[model samples]
Target: MADLASLQSGPLRDLPYRVAWRARGVHAGAHRGTSSGAGGLFRDLATLLEAPDPRRLDLRASLRDPFEQLYVRRFERSTAITIYALIDVSASMGFVGNMRKLEVAAAICAALSFSARRIGDRFGVIGCDREIVPELHLPAARARAGAVVAALRTFRPTRRGAGGLVDAAAQIAGRRKLVLLISDFQIAADELAAVFEALAAHDTVPIQLIDSAEAASLPRFGLLPLADLETGRRRLVVLRPSLHAAWQRERAEHEALLASLAARYARPPFRIVDRLDWDRLAAHLMEARG
Candidate 1:
């Protein structure tokens, strides 16, 4: 378990994000939307009868009309959107090194919840491992951030697999949402592909949690005792410079594969290595085209 005091000391700041595609909904919000209403970006002009809004009548356009037709200035309405955090709570997420992976995930969720509510957007969370954990599920709502943080502080990842992610995806299938898929991504390649396929409809952003001590900071030569968090398997091996080099090469290859896979279904994965960088994450969210 992570030290709650340390996690609380450096609360993540609210991040800025934008959706490239036009949002679809009727509720008023901070993002650009498809609906035309009273106030927003000016879309186009329509005849008075078409829009039926006397308040929006364009006097100049009416005067220039050859047939003396009245025109109304139409504007696109800003709309609200749902933001969900789909968290992978598999045993690997419990790993603690330079930083606790699950603790970082929880902090992100807290920040997102606060930010979403600040902009009048609905926020929700789903924790999954072998199956959806009912206690860790929060339905989309305009809830207070304190509630979200409190709930996640008690979350413990003890399960083996991330198979429940597919099931969680199904539950939020109808409307398009800003889904933040937070995980260490330790699942098999085929399983990860399947999870991405399941969440293809939404605007998914992959947030990979990483700890340097996992692979990068090992001693050149030592007797290492390693354990698989998911499988509960243990091994003691002699670590050599050659072995370290091999491990790093394999890690790089896996990273490349993850990036390739993410580009196909979502934006490039935003990595939180050792610690989270708020500015980098905000920039990634704002600039991602996919």
Candidate 2:
């Protein structure tokens, strides 16, 4: 398990994240906002007819053009981004093989909220299962990383359906906020697909939480009885060498399909719950910034 204190205090304490998509916030911060302002990051050159901002006219560009058409500079205004940590507190997340997935989720949430605070971004947390957990919904605020961590610590995985993701995503405002979605994706592809569609308006960062045992080799010879965490259905089956190999292949294919779908919105980052590494997550955040 990751040390919560380490996340709150260390070299990674004030880790910064790069926003992949432009934010639509009105407050002044780090991310690029949709609304243009007097002073911001220079975007590119544009014709005066297109921009209509005479004050931004580039005198040199206008002189270079033979036709002498006026050129204006376009800038992207910096705005404070609202970072939301949407965590899945379903029964599957409680899988305690080598480490509890719920603990991993909470740790990640702590790190993200602290990082957001360091960058002057508003931080929020939404814990959901079959339904949204009202008590766990923390509205976006600055310097509330400790409160977010405390709320996540109280969360316990319960047996809940996976139909609330779309509804939960809808609860977020359509202001192009940054959503750090952490989940052990045990739901069906069709259901998860709806969630992606609902959250298309925001910049979602998918952190697929996986138990180490899930990716490891299974017993080649055993009569294992597996029970569905959500449905509570039990099935006993003999695990042969062939069966184990087939399961591995199927899991790989499913992961590949998920990666393809997730890439359309944000780069997917996989975190093994048993051996959570902050450095690996930092690298992913850096890549995401690009």
lDDT of each: 0.85, 0.75
* lDDT by residue for model 1 (149-178), tens: 566666767779999999999999987899
| Clash list (residue pairs), candidate 2 | none
Tens digit of lDDT per residue, candidate 2, span 155-174? 67776666666777888857
The deviation in Å at residue 233 for candidate 1 is 1.0
Number of the top-ranking candidate, with TM-score as the measure = 1
lDDT of model 2 at residue 75? 88
Report per-prediction Cα RMSD to one decimal. 2.5, 3.7
- TM-score of candidate 2 against the unseen true structure: 0.80
